[model samples]
Target chain A: MAEEIEISISPTGQVTVRTIGIKGPKCVQAAEAVAKIIGQIESRELTSEYYEAEGHVSGQIEVRGRR
Target chain B: MSSVILVTPLIIANWSVISAAVLGACGAMGFTVASGAVSGSGRARSGSSVTRAEIEVENSEVLAGGGGTDEEMVVEKDGVRATFSRDARGALKVCMEGTGYSKGQLKQIGQELMEQVTQQYVYHRVVTELKERGMPIVHEEVEADRTVKIRVRNW
Candidate 1:
C-alpha cells in the first residue's frame, strides 16, 4: 500500500497528523518531522497497527499481541 | 484516531521578524496594509470600542535578533484594522478594530488570521525540513476545508 500522511487543523489551532499504510518505526519517523513543526504534542496514542512488521525491514515478520 | 498525534502550536515572535508571514496571511485573507511599513509601537485605530483578541505564540523567537522593544505592523481592510506587536514577555500580540463586527465576530476573525499565519509559517519550515531530509514531496493540496495536505516520501 502507498504511504500517506494526512494532517488536520482544528478551528482552535490544534493539529492532528495521521500516518497511513506505513509499517513499524518508519511510520513514526515519517510523521515526526512534520509533527515537530506544527507545535507541542499534547498527547499521542499508538494504534495496534504500529506493532506490525515494517514492510521494508528485511526478513522480519514482527508482530506482537495486543497490549 | 489512535495513529494520530495531536499538536498545539505556540506562536510567538517580534512583529518585525514576522512581518512577512503576517503580510502573507493578510494577502491570503483579503487584507491590505494601508501604509508601507512602520517601526516602533503604534496602534492602527484610536478611540474605538473595538473587540480585542490575543494569541500568544509559544516557543517562538524574534527573527529580528535585536530586542522587540519597538516594532509594530498595521494592516487594514474595509472595516478592519489590525496591529501586530510583541509584548514585554516576547509573545506576539494582535489587536483588531472593526466597527460593524460584534465582539464574537472579531474574535473569530482574529483566530482565523492567527491560524492562517501559523499555517503559512509552518508550511515553509516543514518543506525546508523535508528537503533537507531528502524526502521529496509526492503530493500537496489545499483542501476545500482550508486544511493543507502534504505527502512526502523517501526515494
Candidate 2:
C-alpha cells in the first residue's frame, strides 16, 4: 500500500499532519520530521490500526513423516 | 485509521532562518523585498494603525550566550509593507504596515504571510530530513491555503 501524508495549516498558523496507509512505529517516524520542524509534538494519538501487526502474515507448515 | 498528529507550531527559528523563510514566502506571494532604509519622509498619512500585526520569534541562545547584533528587514507588495525587526526581548518580530488594506485585511495578510513562512520552513526542514534518511519523495505540493504537503516513502 502506498503511504500518504497530509499536512493542513489553518489560517491561524496551526499545522496538522496526518499519516494514512502506514502502520506501527513507522507512522510516528514519518511525521516526526514535521513535528520537529514546526516546534514540538503537542499531543499524539494512536488508532487501533497502529496496534495491528505490521506487514502480511503467512502461515508455514512443517510435516514430518517417519523420522 | 492510520494515525493523526496535531502540532502546535512554536517558532524558535533564528534571524537568518526566518529571513530565508520570509524571502521564500514573499517570492511565492509575489511580494518584493523593499529596502529597509525607506525614509520617513512620505507625503501622506493613513488613519488606520500602521502596525497591523506582530509575530515574536524567541531565540533562547541569544540571551544565554553573548549579545548578538539586531536584525531588521522590510518587504512590500503594492502599499502593504512588512517590517521584521528584533524586539527588546531579543525576539524577532514581523510588523505589518500599510494603508491600502483595512485592519482586518492587513491582519489576514499578516497571518497568511506568517503561515507561508512557517510552511516553507517546515517543507525545507522535512525534505532535508527525509533526504538525509534516504527516504524517497513520492510527491510534494503547496496547497491552496499555502500548506506544503510532502509524501515520502520508505523502501
Candidate 3:
C-alpha cells in the first residue's frame, strides 16, 4: 500500500499531520519516522486511522476462556 | 536523601525557552523546540467563549514517539475524547475541540477554539518529548487555550 503522510505548519507555527494507508502501532512507527524528519513534538492529535492502520502488537494478543 | 534536583538533568539546552506558552489560532510560541503546530480559521458569523485543556503522554521512547532525543506522542481530540498515535511519516498529529458556547463572532469563536485546542495540543506534545528523554518532571499546569505553565530542570 502506498501510504500518504501529510504535515502542515500553520502561520502561527503549529504542525498537523495526516497519514493514510497505515494504522495502529505501525502508525506509531510512521510517527517515529516523521518526527525524525521534522524534529521534536510540542503536542499533537491523531485519528482512528492511525490505530487501524497501525495494527495490533502480537504481544498484546490475549487468549480467553479455557487456556 | 537525593534532593529533587538529583533526578533532573544537570545541563540545560542552549536556547532559552519560554516559561509560558500560548497556542493561538496558530501554533505554539515558546521554548527552544517547535514541532507539531498549526493554525485555525473561523467563518464570518460565529460567536462564543473558549475553553482549553492539555493532554499528556506518559511512557514514551524518545525516538519512537516522534523524533529527536525529545520525542512527543502525537494525538488528536474530538469534543471530549482525544486520539493519540504516531504517523508513518513521523509527524505528531492532534485533533481537539473547543467550547460549544457562542461568545463572539464566527471568526472570533473559531480563533478562540483554535487557540484552546492548539494549546492543549502543544501541551501534550511537549510532555511526550520530556518524558522520552527520561528527564525528571518538575511541574506542569494547564490553563485551557490561553496558556500552559511548565517548569522542568535540565539534564
Candidate 4:
C-alpha cells in the first residue's frame, strides 16, 4: 500500500500533519519530514498503528484459549 | 492513521518568498500594493496626523543577505495604509496607519494581515517542499473558512 500524508493548515497558521499506511518508526519519520518542511512540532500523538510492525495489516485478532 | 503532529509555523525565507506572502495577504485582505519603495524605519511621519500601529510577525525571520531591495512594501486600502518591512534583526514587521481609524483598529488590521501572511507562507512552503520530496499531491482544497488542506501520496 502506498503511504499517504495529509496536511491541514488552519487560517490562523496552525498546521496538523497525519500519516497513513505507514507504521512503526517510519511513521515518526513521516511526521518529521513534514515538520522539517513546515516548522517546529508543538505536540505529537502516536496511535495504535504506530506500535504495529511495518507492513502489518490492522484489525487482526489473536485468539488465545486453554487448549 | 499512524501519527498526528501539530506544528507552529516559523517564517524563515528570502525576500522573494516573504514578499510573495505579503502580497498574497494584501490581496486577500482587499489591500493593494501601493509602492515597492517606502521607508522601513517603522516610524510615523513626523508632522503627520495619522494614527499608527505596528505589529511583528511572530516567530518569523527574513533570511539575511538576500539580493532584494531594502525598500519596504507599502499597501493601501481605503484611507488606511500598511508597510511591510524587515527589522534590523531580520524579522518581519508591519505598520498600519490611517487618519480615521483608532489605534486598536489598526492593530486589529495588522494582526489579521499577519495571520493571512502566515497562512500563505505555510501553504507555499508545504507544497514546494512536498513536491521537492517527490510526493505527488493528490488532493488540495481551500475551505470556506480559508483553511487549506493538502494530501500527498508517496508511492
Candidate 5:
C-alpha cells in the first residue's frame, strides 16, 4: 500500500502536517521534509500512534488526530 | 492502492479575537490580504454576523497552470475573516482581509515568513508520520514549499 502525507501552510506562515504511513522516528522525518519546503520551524507534536505505531501492519501507518 | 492524507494548518497568533491572526498572517503572505477588522480561513463556515475578510490566491506565474483564474474563499473567526483557494496544478493559494495594516506589504512579509515556516512544518509533520508507524527517522530534508519537498526515505 502507498502511504500518504498531507501538508498545510497557514496564513501566519505556520505549517501543519499529518500523514498516513509506516510510523516511528521515520514519520518525523517525513513531516519535517514538508515543513522545510514552505518556510521556518516553530513547534511540533506527536500523536499517540507515534509511540504505539511500533512495528508495522500491512505496510501502512494509521493516523487518529489524537495521540 | 494510492492513499491520501488530510493536513490541517494549526494557526497561533495574537488572537485576542480568534481570526485577527488569520488576517494579519494572510496579509503578511503575498498570496492574500485582510479587508475588515478580523480574518480567518481553513475551518468551516458559521451563521454568525461579524467583520468579514476575503483572501484571493492563484498560480500567478502559471508555474503549473495555464493562466487560470485565481480562487478565493471567505472565513469568519471571532469577528474576523479568512479564505483559501488553489490553482489548476495543485499550487495552493490563500487570502486574508481586515488588518488596517499595509495594503500590499503584508503579502511580501508573508512570503518571507512562509519560507521558514514551511521548513519547520515539514520537519514536524515527517516526525509525526514516523512515530505513528512506530518506525524511526532514517533520513529527511525540508526546504521551502516550491523549492523542496519533505522526502522521508524510511527504512
Candidate 6:
C-alpha cells in the first residue's frame, strides 16, 4: 500500500495532520515531521491501526497446534 | 492509519519566506504590495479623518536577513492601506487604515489578512518540507470556506 500524508489547514490557521497507510511508530514520525515544519503540536491521538503490527492484516488469527 | 496531530502555527521564518506568504495573502485578498520600504507611502494617509486598527499574527516570529530588514511591507486595495511589520518583540504586526472605513471594518480586514498570511505560510512550509523529505504533494485543494487541504504520497 502507498503511504500518504493528509493535511488540513483551517481558515483560522489551525492545522490537523494525519498519516495514512503508515503503521506503527513510523506513522508518528511522519506526523511529527510535518508538525515540526508548521508549528507546535497541541495534541496527538493514535488510532487503533497504530497498535497493529506492520504488514499484519485485520481480523486474521492464526491457530497453532503442538506438533 | 496511524496518528492525528493538532497544531498551532508558529511563523518563525526569514524575511523572504514571510514575504512570500504575505504576497500570497495580499493576492488572495485583492491587495497589491505598494512598497518594500517601511518608510514608503503604504501607510494610511495621516489625517484626523482616517481610522486605524492593528492586529498581531499569533505565535509568529519574523526573522531578519535573507533580504529582510527592520522594514515593513505595505499593501493597498480599495482605499485601504495595510502595513506588515515586526514588532519590538519580533512578532508579526499588521496595521490597517483607511479614510472612510471604521475601526471595526479595518479590524475585520486586518484579521482576515492575518489569517490568510497564516494559511499561506503554513502551506508553503508544509509543501517545501514535504518535498525535501521525498513526499511530494499528490493533491491540493481549497475548500469552499477557504480551508486548504493537501495530500502527499510517500514513496
DockQ of each: 0.39, 0.47, 0.01, 0.72, 0.06, 0.69
- What tens digits encode model 3's per-residue C-alpha lDDT throughout A16-47? 43444555555545444444433455444555
lDDT of 4 by residue, B88-139 (tens): 7778898899988999999999888899999999999998988787889999
Clashing pairs in 2: none
**Which has the higher DockQ value, candidate number 4 or candidate number 6?**
4
User: For all the models shown, what interface RMSD does each have?
Assistant: 2.5, 2.6, 15.1, 1.1, 8.2, 1.1
Ten contiguous residues with the weakest lDDT in model 2 chain B: B59-68
Give a tens-digit lDDT track for model 6, residues B1-155. 56999999999987778888999999999999888656333445768998999998879888877756577889999999999988878898899989889999999999999998999999988888888888778899999998999999855
In angstroms, how far off is B30's CA in candidate 5? 13
| Interface RMSD measured for model 1 | 2.5
Quality of candidate 6's docking, in CAPRI categories?
medium
Best by DockQ: 4
In the range B1-155, model 2's lDDT, one tens digit per residue, is 86778887665556666567778877888888886433232322367555365655432211222223365568889888887655667665668778656767777787778777766666666677667868787877666765566666643
Score every model by TM-score.
0.78, 0.72, 0.27, 0.88, 0.29, 0.87
Q: Could you report the Cα RMSD, in angstroms, for every candidate shown?
A: 6.2, 6.3, 19.7, 3.6, 16.8, 4.2
In model 3, where do residues sit more than 4 Å from their true spots? A1-67, B1-104, B142-146
lDDT of 4 at B28: 90
Which candidate has the highest lDDT of all?
6
| Residue runs of model 5 more than 4 Å from their true location after superposition | A54-67, B1-155
Model 4, residue B130: C-alpha shift (Å): 1.4
Candidate 6 segments whose C-alpha is farther than 4 A from its true place: A58-67, B39-44
